[model samples]
Target: MTAWETERVAWAYLSRVTQGPSRVVSDFVERYGVVEAVRAIKSGVVPRVVAERVSARAHIDTAAADLDAVAALGGRLVIPTDDEWPAWRLVGFQTGEFGGRADTSVPLALWVIGGRSLLDVTERAVAVVGTRAATAYGEHVAGEISGDMAVDGWTVVSGGAFGIDGVAHRAAMGVGGVTVAVLACGVDRAYPAGHARLLQQITSSGLVVSEYALGTTPAKHRFLARNRLVAAFGEGVVVVEAGWRSGARNTASWARSLGRPVVAVPGPVTSASSAGCHRMIRESEARLVSNARDVVEEIGSALSGDDEQDHLFSRGDDRITGPAILVLDALPGSGSLGPHEISELSGVPMSDVRAALVMLEMESLVVRDDTGWARAQRRR
Candidate 1:
């Protein structure tokens, strides 16, 4: 095998033996090289901690079998050196602060099963995650935002579980857009079992990725560890609905730590499912997102090179047209007006006025308050 192939095999073996972060193994690989580390492990000359975890002979055999299985499934082992790897997404984890756990190292390799390249699908990705016991409203919002994001050329990334994650993936796929499902377990094995078909669809058009070896099962701690990968893989993360202690909140924490934008969709205050989202917004940990447009705007701002003032208020005059411009013109300079008021003032139909309001809001030319909508104050 070539050097890359040799490294792939060694990483796969290391993945099987290491339970959690593999910081020690990563350090060993960095110090002595993958080939040398593998040799030392096989010779029982490695650290006591690693030696106790794996019997050299059995572990090596398992690793070989894992590789064979992956090959049989038509999957590829992607290391950092691979051309198709999403290196940019993994950059923040370079310092080993993955999941905000200093002991845990970033994944050394990923088992990717998909037709499209990882980078191709994840170049402009957003993560939509929430509670498994999502309400009807939460699911609806997740679907709408995910579908819209997909249609706008942004891939939706999520854990392959029930509730928000499943809805997000299906919504993205329904629109014939690429979506990635990051798994806590091995990509070959479906953790929920129910999402097997959905995962297959994702792989056919996008990607199913995991850091684990072929047969690793999903454990409670594994899912927590996996959230970091989900957070890191996307440009921003959207939590549709999460209760207190929800795993989605954990993902949000990881996103914040990585300096990636975190957006929370507000739900009814009475609902427990939305408590985490409300807390995030209240604590100023995440920006509030009401629709796909809001999500796009928040993430775009983070990615844009424009100055804050310019990005917030500077839109070309020609960009606003038709009913949108009419509605903007109708708004009072110092006070808010409802959509109905704007419709009457602009001589535009109520339906057109509503549509215009959405467009205007996205452009930051208008602001909505409890009373109504008003023209946004332009930066001097």
Candidate 2:
């Protein structure tokens, strides 16, 4: 084998044997080159902390098997020196402390499965993350924003979990846009199992990536560690919905620490799922984003020197007009209400309410079902 391939295999082996925070592995690789570091670990001359956790002498065979398994799966191992690695931006996060984990470090290697390069796929990526138990409103907003971003040639990045993540991926794919799924488990192993099909679709058009070796299962700590990768990979992160203690909050924190812009979509006041997003906005940690336009503006400003006015939210004249606006606003986000109920709530005359509802229905701003009327799913 070539010298580069030999070193790549050794780095992959080290990734399998190392445990107890990524900083230990990162520091070792930094202090000694990949080949020399592997030799030191095998010779039992490494630091006491790492040595205690990594019994390299015992797991050498398994590590070799892990490399073989990845190869069998057609997975690519990308190290720091690889041309396809996104080192320019990821290097910044690796050198900084995040989530109070001083031991946190950049991944030793990334296992990717896809046809596109990691650097190219994430060149203009934006992460849309949120709760696994998402509300309908949250899902709608996530899908709309993700779809718009994809149509504009920006890749959507997210954890391959259910709820918002699934919606975002589907939306981007629906528009024939690229997306990247950063996984806590091996790229070959789908954690939610239900998203197996979704992950397959992503790999066909984009990429599925992880830091763990093949066969590694998803764990609580691994997910937490994986959050940093999601945050660091995107130029900015948008939290669609998150509870008080959601994993999405961890990603937002990492984005802030990495000097990346954080945006939060506001949810109804009564939703517990939106508590974390509201808190972030109130604390000035994240800007409020109501639609795709808001997201594009925020991300564009952060990414380029273009004038803000040049990228303003451009909703065409198709926006709801006249009494239709009042009637549409009167509708509840959840259940439907009749015209009389909407008239009473909106203070519009009954005659005007009926006329506005007709106009709104034709424009798809509202829908009339067997129960009554409700706001239609409008994508902006």
Residue 361: error of model 1 in Å? 38
TM-score of decoy 2: 0.77
How many angstroms is residue 73 displaced in model 2 relative to the true structure, after the best TM-score fit? 2.3
lDDT tens digits by residue: candidate 2, 63-113: 656667777766688877676776544644543445567546768889888
Clashing residue pairs for model 1? none
User: How far off is model 1, as Cα RMSD?
Assistant: 16.1
Summing lDDT over every window of 10 consecutive residues in candidate 2, give the lowest-scoring window: 308-317
Please write out the lDDT profile of model 1 over residues 1-380, one tens digit for every residue. Answer: 88887888887777777644666777677678777888888877888765665554424546667788887877878875566766556545543334436534668788889888886677778999999999999999999999999999999999989999999999999999989999988888987999889898888888999987787899988898789889878888999999987999999988876667899999999999999999999999899999999999998777653543222222234344445655776677699998888887665679978888888888887899999999887665
